[model samples]
Every structure is written in C-alpha cells, then in structure tokens.
Target: MTEILDTAVDFRATMGRLATGVSVITTRSGSTPVGMTASAVSALSLAPLQLLVCIGNHLYTRTAIAEHGRFAVNVLGEDGEALARNFAASKADKFAGVETVDDHGVPVLKDAIAAVVCDVAEALPGGDHTIFVGAVRHCTHRVDCRPLLHFAGGFGALRTPRHA
Candidate 1:
C-alpha cells in the first residue's frame, strides 16, 4: 500500500469547497488610496480583539499598511463581486469608479457587509506572506446584508435553507 499527497492544484481545489467570506483590505499612505481583495482574513481573538490579514510581499498593500500603520477589512456581499475583482486586479485605477469614503480619514468602500478598522499591532513573517495582526479600533456593519462568500477560487452563496 502507498499513500500520495495530492498536487497543490488539487489541494487548492479541495479547499475551495470550504466556503469563505471575501473582503477588501484597504489602507492609505501619503495621498494614495491602496487596496486589494483578499480571502485570507481570520478572526484570532476576542478578549483583546484581534484579526489577521495576509499580504504578499510584492503587492502595493504590503507597503501601504506598513507605512500607514492601519487598515480596514471591508467585508463584501455577493453583489460586490465586481468590486472584489477590481480591487484584486493589477491596474492603475482600481478606485476610480468605486464608491468609498474616508474612514477615520482612511478610504473605505461604501455598503460593505461589515468593515473593521484596525491598527497594525504587529507584522510577522508567514512563509511567502506577511501576517498582519491588528488590534481593532472601530467596527461597523450593514443592517441586513449577507456577506460575500468565496469558494474554490470563485464567488458563492451558501445554500442556506429556511427553517420550516
């Protein structure tokens, strides 16, 4: 008998089956608005309030958060897929047509399912990415919007069945 680990693609596909929420990680430095879409956010605590966002070394956001010392996780809804795609792409005008406001003087897209403004408490090296642990400063949420969910590298809505 032999055991074999699946390839990265296959493993990634398998993990994609586990639905996860999508968020736009936003920050600003100097006079530029910097943001990127990420699904790697995870709530790490409650007693002291904490969460983590993974930033790739090559992305503009990696530099922005480090310089600005603060960030906001703008949780999107199912209808925000286009915005997510816009923020995730490599372009010079990601925010040109986006409707966002200065949050505590920092840019935050409007109508997010939820938004968490946090200060970068620490940044730790995590393999090929940097794990930014933040201490929440302020938070807000939409009254009745379901958050955007992602799975298998695609957008999805959980098949939530209504109770009888």
Candidate 2:
C-alpha cells in the first residue's frame, strides 16, 4: 500500500529528514562581498570538476554571482553554526564582524572546513531558485575539521557510534 502526501509542509518535513552539509555561497557585487547560507549544493561532475548550487531568485548573492560569473562555496566546520545563522538572516550587511580572506576575487571564510572557487558555467531556472553550475577553479580543504550538518530544521554534528 502507498500513501500520498499533498502539502508543502509534508514535502518540507520529508525533505528535512535528509541531512546535508552546510555551506556559505559567496560572491562579489562590485567590491563588496555578498553571501548566503545554503544546503542545496552538490558536485555535478568530476571529469571537468563541476558543482551546482541552488540560490533563491531574489537573493543578492544570486545576482552577484550572475553579474560576476564566479562564486566560492565555503563548507562550514562544526563550530560554524553562528556563521550560518548570520548569513541566513535578512540583513543589509551579512559580512559584518565576519572574518574572511579574498580568494582571487571572492571572499572565503577563514575557518571553514573547505572552500571551493568556481567560474559559472550555466544558469538554469528552477521554480523560485536558480541553479548555478560552476567549473572548479580552485579548492582548499582542512583534513582535521568536522563538517557542520543540517537535519530536521536544526544544525548538528556527526558522531561515531561507540563499540561496546
């Protein structure tokens, strides 16, 4: 037997069960940096080293990435929940008080678990969001950092089960 769920809330609740790594998608508008917290990021290809990020159509980061044709994905560490919340808020200055360094022309979080710079390859419309597919230009990672994760509408960390 199969059951059907026909509501947005049900869809969101079902989707939220799938845990995801958190990342800040950063881009520059002129000389100023803009970014947003995102979990809808994924590697699309390996032959050309490509990745895709889904950005809200109205987000400033989306516009900046479109104009600049470049972006950086900063994968947050386990301790970066504050940073994630800051970027996720609706504010004029999301970068205020945040520590960052310029990577080429994009801003990358200094303490993130990993960062990947990319040049936009394509932009596809997906309902209220735009999917930006990027070709990898540069990437850096820290082996010792634990990734921040999101699931069931909350941030969490991965824990290994203890063997008795």
* Backbone Cα, N, C clashes tallied per candidate: 1, 0
At residue 91, what lDDT does model 2 achieve? 96
lDDT of the structure predicted as candidate 2? 0.94
Show the lowest summed lDDT stretch of 10 residues, model 1.
1-10
Clashing pairs in 1: 16-152
Kindly list the per-residue Cα lDDT of model 1 for residues 1-164, writing each as its tens digit.
15555887777777788888999999997888899999999998897999999999888899999999999999998788998899999998788988898887578889588999999999999877899999998888886567778977888765555659
What is the total number of backbone clashes in candidate 2?
0
| Candidate maximizing lDDT | 2
lDDT values, one for every candidate: 0.88, 0.94
Against the true structure, candidate 1 reaches a TM-score of: 0.90
